[model samples]
Target: MCDYTQREYSCGHFRWIASKWCREYTLTHKRCQPNVTHFEYRADEPCGECKPKEYPPWENLIRRNKQATY
Candidate 1:
């Protein structure tokens, strides 16, 4: 069985992060094998993928310039 760690987000979402692999799988695999297991440890924070990304100041300026030209 594959082992995973549980991550809890402030947005009320849970994500499973891979921790260990069994004999049948390696790092290159995209998905866990069947009969996965989770570690008792948990993390509490906002999920990086679910959080909104902020644009840099220069990027905002470029967008405004393009809009003005239209």
Candidate 2:
């Protein structure tokens, strides 16, 4: 397997979007903030990231993972 220079993560919330979001997703990369490891997606396999076909982003959700620490 190949490991990119980046990573991926998410958060767990009880009342809000997880108060720990501050602890997680707080890494800095490429001068940006997506402090998580995002797997390299093949041109034909973009679905691998959100596998199990459930975490699809609807018109109401955004990919603010800026470092998902889940």
Candidate 3:
């Protein structure tokens, strides 16, 4: 059954940095501090932020992926 829900995302900036051992990601930020990782990035990088957005459908997307993989 299709539930009456929607998917949305907060207007936030995100960045993924790759390392030899693991990958790092950012969801939000508090200041203008530059996020660093093992991979090289410019020093003029800005942190991410979040704004009002939908949520329910996005959760379902994650769940669906997990179920399919498992």
Candidate 4:
């Protein structure tokens, strides 16, 4: 089973998403700062409280970096 995490965005949004340590720590990939506010082990239910941001703030940083390299 995949690990699920409760993360908070810089915009104060929160979401329960799959935990991907490689994506978070790998330097070659775009970093997604889903500040893991909590970890839900054996999460059988979805979060119904916190609303997630429509767009992650870190996406912008990735776009900028790609443009600079081009």
Best by lDDT: 1
Q: Is candidate 1 or candidate 4 better by lDDT?
A: 1
- TM-score list, all predictions: 0.57, 0.16, 0.16, 0.23
Q: Candidate 2 lDDT, tens digit per residue, 1-70? A: 2122332223221111222233323553222232333443234333334445664568357647678697
lDDT of 3 by residue, 1-70 (tens): 1112222223334445322222222323222323343333334444444433557756866634435553
Give the candidate order by descending lDDT.
1, 4, 3, 2
- TM-score top scorer: 1
Rank order (by TM-score, best first): 1, 4, 2, 3
Candidate lDDT scores, in order, read 0.63, 0.34, 0.35, 0.52
Model 3, position 44, has a per-residue lDDT of 49
lDDT of 2 at 20: 24
lDDT of 1 by residue, 1-70 (tens): 6787776677667777777776667745656554536534234556777678887778746534435553
lDDT of model 2 at position 67: 81
For candidate 2, give the lDDT: 0.34
List model 4 lDDT by residue over 1-70, tens digit each: 2345775544455567756555445655564555554554433433444434466767767534435553
